[model samples]
Target: MSLLQRLIARPPPPRTAARVAVATELPGGDEVDVLWVRDPRARRLRLLVSERGARLTVPLRASQREAQQFLDVNLPWLAAQLARRAARDVRPAFGRGDPGPLPLRGQLRPLEWREARLLRIEERDGSIVIQAPPAASDAMVRRALRDFYIAQARRDVGRWLPAYMPGLPRAPRSVRFRPLSSLWGSLSPSDAVSLDLALVLGPPAAFEYVLVHELCHLIHPNHSRAFWREVELRCPQWRALRAWFRGDGLALKAEMKRLVGP
Candidate 1:
């Protein structure tokens, strides 16, 4: 690099005058550079990186050294995760062409646009179908399916709770929706089951497997042999479904993200 080229290189922005250590090493074994992003509305530190640079946006109340140390310890894990994410990358299958028909619960269903007020499921000439009314936009279709699936999931779970665990108290009384980036669902001790809305777009088998797994938790809170035995008894194909989800979860999650907007 010539001295003239160095002199012509851009200088740091004023907001990032204070330097911080970055969380990852670059491809050439160089430590990545960090830029401080301060926003008064920020309530915590947010670290993000891109080809341009690594950025650490911090709240006014944050302890810079503490945040840096935390990132340092987690750097390798973060890098590995990011690498995996980069490897399993996907692009939106929407607008390019029809994603064509999708299978739901062992039935082939086509997604169609119609001008109607309600999102509905109906059987048509020996085929089960999901339809969005003509006024329905992609966002509406996505949201309606999410709501329908979660509600149906709640009812389905409610029905099995009693049959599986006779005389069990409360019967898994409440089912709730939540966004979980890691797992599909969770069952709290208070009879509340939190389901990931993202699972609605997964393969039908994966969706059912997760629902059954969480519902089984109402009886066995821990993943004990008895709990798994219960899962196997209720969902015989669970192992295969689990393996499928493991391979496809990232792709499904990416689709969900696109539907909801990244």
Candidate 2:
């Protein structure tokens, strides 16, 4: 190694694990640990590194050599992730207004608001509609929508749980709402359901569809044929409804953000 290289002490290159391992390179140092896992059912190699650590989730067929190559190629990405985590760890505040434009459903939109009671929805005869109170500023409107989704989840999630899952013998232990980036709702195996607050700002039908989808999970955890059949039983045209949600209902989140300003 050159004098500069030796003095700088380039962290050792990541090493590949054994063939039995899913395939990923070893982390350079203890500052950030790495894990490799092979999933027979996985279609492709995927990497997930968060505040906790880095891990490789890849197809079982991937060889250790391939895993190591993948890790080497993604070294810069992994290092950047570590840096981001380090930065976030020192973040100063929480619950800041306008968490900067967040994605509601699929569209990215700005969230702005003030305090008000009226809940209004506006759309220019298109896929996305803005839901907020006229007097309520953008921030307040988002807050209202957030509150609305939470209240609705409490009422809606439990109603369908027992109906769809008769074997449960009792109502779901708890139902709650939070901001979820990707899904409208999720059902936990432990009888808990979490609703995404963004849903409250979505169309009424979207809310219903989400309610139906999540409740079905109480009985069927996986997206198996039986699970879809259950969803169909509740909303015969659920497929079409979901399509509408993807195309239209999902955009309400963006609409709300844009129309409601800081």
Candidate 3:
């Protein structure tokens, strides 16, 4: 009985090969970590590049060699992307005598910092005055500035929300603000609208565009043709506004990063 049972069981067929990963150095001397993933549903190989690094997704039948080959072929593109990311992360030193004005509401507003008993920000005569405590550090001053922007975003977004509501299927249940890293705005399935506080640095037109974009999502959750049509119908100049946000808005984000790391 024991002999027959052992012969029939066959030790669970010796299991398939486990997934593996390896690190390889690019021609530019940058190291890339490659993961060999087994995705049953994957129809073909795909490469994803990000600030962190590059990732290769492969089908179950693919080998580690294939993944490595893909990385080798895409090394140039990967290197350029990594270089751009490195440059983006290198924030300019923000202190006395920095050139130009601070970006606020899509315009370069004069930045004035001074010592005071408490931190306070005020907008007077086309200038943003920031008063920090005597012992306040740069990070502390940055925090105060961020808080000011968040408050400003809240006020501005609230004012703009009402103007776009009549075009939507129904007004959002609520509007909220957050300091988001990667998203300008998002519409929840529960009818809540959340906007990025960093958006306060962008132009008023860009802010209005984002608000309208999220509002359209209340009717069509996906970016289908119908959803975009609705957006175009409501905001005819949305295309230009979007282009401005992508170009100028990114500059604002980089400046904010310089002020407040990450």
Best by the lDDT measure: 3
User: For every model shown, what is its TM-score relative to the native structure?
Assistant: 0.51, 0.43, 0.66
For candidate 1, list the clashing residue pairs, or say none: 114-133, 114-134, 115-134, 116-134
The residue-by-residue lDDT of candidate 1 on 163-199, one tens digit each, is: 6555343466677765566567888868777877666
In model 1, the Cα lDDT at residue 22 comes to: 37
lDDT (10s digit) by residue, model 2, range 1-262: 5432231233222343222222233355434456665555455676655323567765546665575678788877777665655554553321324454443334444544333355643323223233444554545555544554355445654565556565433456666776554356788878787766556555555677787787777777777788888788877878887766544432343333333321
TM-score of 3: 0.66
**Model 3 Cα lDDT, one tens digit per residue, 1-262:** 4432332223222333233355757777878675544455455676554433556666555555575577789777656655665776766755433443777787889877777898787787998888777777767767776777778887897787777767777888887866555467899889999887767777787887888899999888877789989899878999998767544554555567666455
Clashing pairs in 2: 110-257, 112-138, 112-139, 113-137, 113-138, 113-139, 113-140, 114-137, 114-140, 120-132
Model 3 residue 115 CA deviation in Å? 2.2
Worst 10 residues of 1 by lDDT: 3-12
User: Which portions of model 2 show Cα errors greater than 4 Å?
Assistant: 1-145, 152-170, 255-262
lDDT of 2: 0.54
Model 1 C-alpha lDDT versus the unseen true structure? 0.58
What's model 2's lDDT at 245?
A: 52
What C-alpha RMSD separates each model from the true structure?
11.3, 11.3, 8.9
lDDT of each: 0.58, 0.54, 0.69
